[model samples]
Target: MYVVVLIVVVVVVVVVVVVVVVVVVVVVIVVHVVAAAVVVVVVVVVGVVVVVVVVVVVVVVVVVVVVVVVVVVLVVVVVVSAAAVVVLVVLVVVVVVVVVVVVVVVVLVVVVVVAAAAVSSPCDHASSSSSSSSSSSSSSSSSSFSSSSTSSSSFFLSFSFFFFFSSSLISPPFSSSSYQSVLIVVVVVVVVVVVVVVVVVVVVIVVVVVEVVVVVVVVVVAVVVLVVASVIVASVIVAAVVVVVVAVVVVVVVVVVVVVVVVVIVVLVVVVAVVVVVLVNFEAFNANYKIYALAF
Candidate 1:
């Protein structure tokens, strides 16, 4: 009976040992499978996430590049168009100013010539009348040399008084002669022409200077505006890129946190299951040990 009991106990112990080993092996295998599964899931998720991030980054970069190119092209076109417009405006202004100045010069010249001619006409008529009157007086004096010595003397006195009075009334320079009057008129006309020409040249120079200044100012403003616009565009592009990078980083961090949480949860559940299995198996082994002791 003792031998039979011992043999039976030995057999029971062997079977229990075998069961515990099998359970342990099964748990280990399950843990390995779970770990492998978790690893595969993590790898797959990470690979997909990496691909998505790369694609997004590439797309954003491409978009930014395209936008920058388009903006640059637009800026160039605008600058060129503005420069062309400024040039055209300057040309038009120059042409208009020149035409106006020429017209004014022509009109002034015509007016001066007319005025000079009108002033010369009265002087010419007066000189001609004086000459004719002197010729008549000379003829009369010769004819009446013997018949009118008193009359000639009286006529000469009256003529001298009349000439003196006329000379007092008219300025000496203008009263000189018709030739002198014409020469004075010519001088006046020439002086006037010279003044007009000088004025016109001065006006043209001033206008040209003003035009140059305006063109310079416009160019400077355009350059400043372009520079400012470029700076703003560059800043915007940089900000957009930074935002995209930050967003990608945030997404990656969130994904990593979620993966870590899932892995931690899986590990905790596996540990709990292993602990429950171990507890149940130990209880069964204790019950079998008590039974073996009672049999002994």
Candidate 2:
């Protein structure tokens, strides 16, 4: 019974150990598989994010550079055109002033010629004829000067107006610093994205390493437990066998002692019975001999 119980205990322990080991192995495998899947997912996500970030950065950089270039070119064109307009305006103002001055000077000359003509008398025919002829020539010259000055003044005013209108229409309002700030912001964003990617990669690597180590430890522990359990089961079986062997030896010794005692008692009883028979036969012979003598 004890041996049977011992065997049952050992079997139970072995079964439990086997079950525990199997469970541990299965758990470890599942954990490893899950960890691997997580790592793969994280890696894929990070890769995709990195790719997207890189593509976005490239596009942003290209766009920023192109925008900066375009803005610079546009600014230069606008500044140059503005400067040209200013120069043209100055020139036009100067021309208009000059035309006004020439017109004033011509008006003063015409007034002087008219005054001279009015002051001279028509008393001397030869002198009157010569004075009339000088007045007529002066009037023609003054008229010609006045017409030319008016035309030049009008032309300059029209040119200045056109330039002012053109300048207003062509120049952009935004500053160069605005464009610089935009570029700076784009660069900072790119840097931030790169940093984030690096951080994510580091985190993923750490997590994977931790998961692998944990799985290894679990597997090692399970194996060690199985080994320890096997050793214990073997020891128990050995102890049970030893107890059964001791019990069997004790039972055999008791049987041998009982058989020896029974044989000794039977031999003593037979020896006593023989001694009694011999004594009774001797007494009977003696009594017969006495009877024979008396009869003689």
User: Which candidate number would show the highest lDDT if scored against the true structure?
Assistant: 1
- TM-scores of the candidates in the order shown: 0.29, 0.24
* Model 1 TM-score relative to the real fold: 0.29
> Which residue pairs collide in model 1, if any?
none
Off by over 4 Å in 2: 1-54, 122-296
lDDT of 2 by residue, 169-224 (tens): 33211123422432343333333323332332333233333434443343333333
Give the candidate number with the greatest TM-score: 1
Cα error of candidate 1 at position 253, Å: 56
lDDT, model 2: 0.38
